[model samples]
Target: MDVEKVFCMNGGLGENSYTQNSYLQKKGSDMVKHITLKSLEEAYVSTTPESLGIADLGCSSGQNTLSTIREMVEAIDKTTYKFSNITPPEYRVYLNDLPTNDFNAVFKILPDFYKELNTERHLWSQKLKSSIYIAGYPGTFYGRLFPDKCLHFIYSSYSLHWLSRIPPGLYDKEGHSINKGSFYISKSSSLQVSKAYLDQFQEDFSLFLQSRSKELQSGGRMVLILLGRRDRTHVDRGNSFLWELLSRSFATLVSKGEVEQEKVDEYDAHFYAPSKNELEHEVKKEGSFEMERFEMFEIEHYSGPYMSHGTAVARTIRAIQESMISQHFGEEILDNLFENYGNLIDEEMGIEEIKPTSFISVLKKL
Candidate 1:
């Protein structure tokens, strides 16, 4: 499905804007530490690699990899220290993301990892005892992101909902589907669009679980963190406030002749929010792993205070498209969307901060 081109549509996590942006970095740093701590606790209970093979799927390229790897190495160290008699094994860690990502960022970090390894070796007889082998790969996760049973541990964050691509049937010469059966297609009411995204997510996630089941060792583990919705009712999918805002906003766009009526009616995904139940349902369908832990919590996503609602609106949209602002929305359309967001946010009921709930789930392969 030309995943390379589609996945490459966005600059990947390496885009200089957010890839290196301070806001995401700070959040990710904390998130990875928490993730590894949990994964390690689980791994300690079940599996000890005579040699360990770990992977960070959709890892992107940057300091984030270091956080996970460091935690992994530490966990192994602590475990070996407690066991004393068992020799710590060689470690092979594969860092992965889409093909178009900046591998250079990963390569640049490797020398530093090894240099520290060598330095530590001399200071203490078995310091940083494991032999570390790090490599990078570019591939779509939907279809065998790695080799069969090749990984002992896997981790991914903030990347699962992105479908390999927007669904083909939904996009026409103008845009994508708006209303199908019970789906909403308005700019502010993009339930149909969000549903499309959810469908694609289910498809992709199911495939991910199936692939991991094949690629993960019998006792391997996986952890994923993603934005999710709180509502579990069938009707709630249609009632998401974010979707409603987007639908109404787009409806305004169509009414004012600012955006194509058909275009607004056709496509969805102004914002994608999925419920935990939906995610759990898909993962269970894969039948490859036992769910060890699932936690959902709300985090205030602040773009910071802006001078005015319009400025805030601009900042908000820019955050999403900073890397490929021109590709997804042409200059004029993007400008219009921002204006709409500003106007909408300033309205009495509009939200200044997006408080989406994100979830972290951990699983152990049987």
Candidate 2:
């Protein structure tokens, strides 16, 4: 599959859209907001650029996208006034994502976004001394996305875990998949399967650091938040269990003849949840940035007042995974698939807790 052309969250403002189902992601972003603001302040004070260039990589469409950017801008604005007693710099903001992402959804809300931003600025002072120019950049973050030494502060939340592509070598000498029964690494997967996933993450993350290193100006700061595992084991009680449940859902479909077993065997998820040690090793190996801060936080999955725990979790996963799954398995079975997924989740909730952990890292270009 062409990942750039096929990968994206479910779009629009419908019930299943990412816009509505991203509360968990929003919570994760809030958990790291202080780190992001602190990093932005340091980047601003160090470089003191007249025009602050900021980029949000993997910036999918929704309120979370602009809300996070607004917070960063506001933080810098306050920092500039406190230190220099002068107007903040003009803002050049780049919002980036895959080519197939719903740029239209983000663009549609810009008028309201700009209006709100202008109103907020007016409240601070009568004069609007600084301007923010926002533009959408469509591409993958695994390679170069900006001009050399241009960006000042970079931010990405809950997005780096997505691999640029499914890891190679999942198949054997005769081209049969080694991870046949699972879409992701699980307790049942062989050591070779775990190694392949980790190898892919190291390659992709190294390239990410290399590309951003070239684009960021000297003394620039980058704050990254991504899903991570707490232990050295390939399987975790959180994300891995979710995938296992989905795998069971697929098995149910296959048995009932609603989906094909061969297609299930051939498919693999283009994602990885790295351990903290793995992240530290890659940062040291890349040799371009200094790690200023590293933190890990966990968010529990719970039932909302209006929905069951299973339903809430199912919608969240569907909003993120439906696009890729639909492309591979056909869209017809999505409803039944997720129904089974939700039921399986409900069955498991009584047995164990579900809490996904995430990592927040602050890196400064040397």
Instruction: Give all candidates' CA lDDT scores.
Output: 0.62, 0.90
Looking at candidate 1, the ten consecutive residues that score lowest on lDDT are 180-189
Off by over 4 Å in 1: 1-16, 25-32, 117-125, 168-176, 179-195, 233-267, 270-272, 303-325, 331-353
Per-model clash counts, in order, read 17, 0
Please tell me which predicted candidate would have the highest TM-score against the true structure: 2
Runs of candidate 2 exceeding 4 Å displacement: none
lDDT of 1 by residue, 59-173 (tens): 7656666766776776676666666666776788887888777677668768988888657654655545567888887788777877787778887876675567655544445
- Residues 1-366 of candidate 2 have per-residue lDDT tens digits of 777789899999999999998988898889789989999999989988889999999899999999988888788777876755566789999999998889999999889998899789779865457888899999999999999999999999889999999888687999888999899998789999998899899999999999999999989999999999998976877888889999999999999999999999989988999999999999999999999999999876754798887888899899999999999999999999999998899888888877778999999999
Candidate 2, residue 184: how far the Cα is off, in Å = 0.7
Clashing pairs in 2: none
Which window of ten consecutive residues has the lowest lDDT sum in model 2?
A: 78-87
TM-score of each: 0.76, 0.97
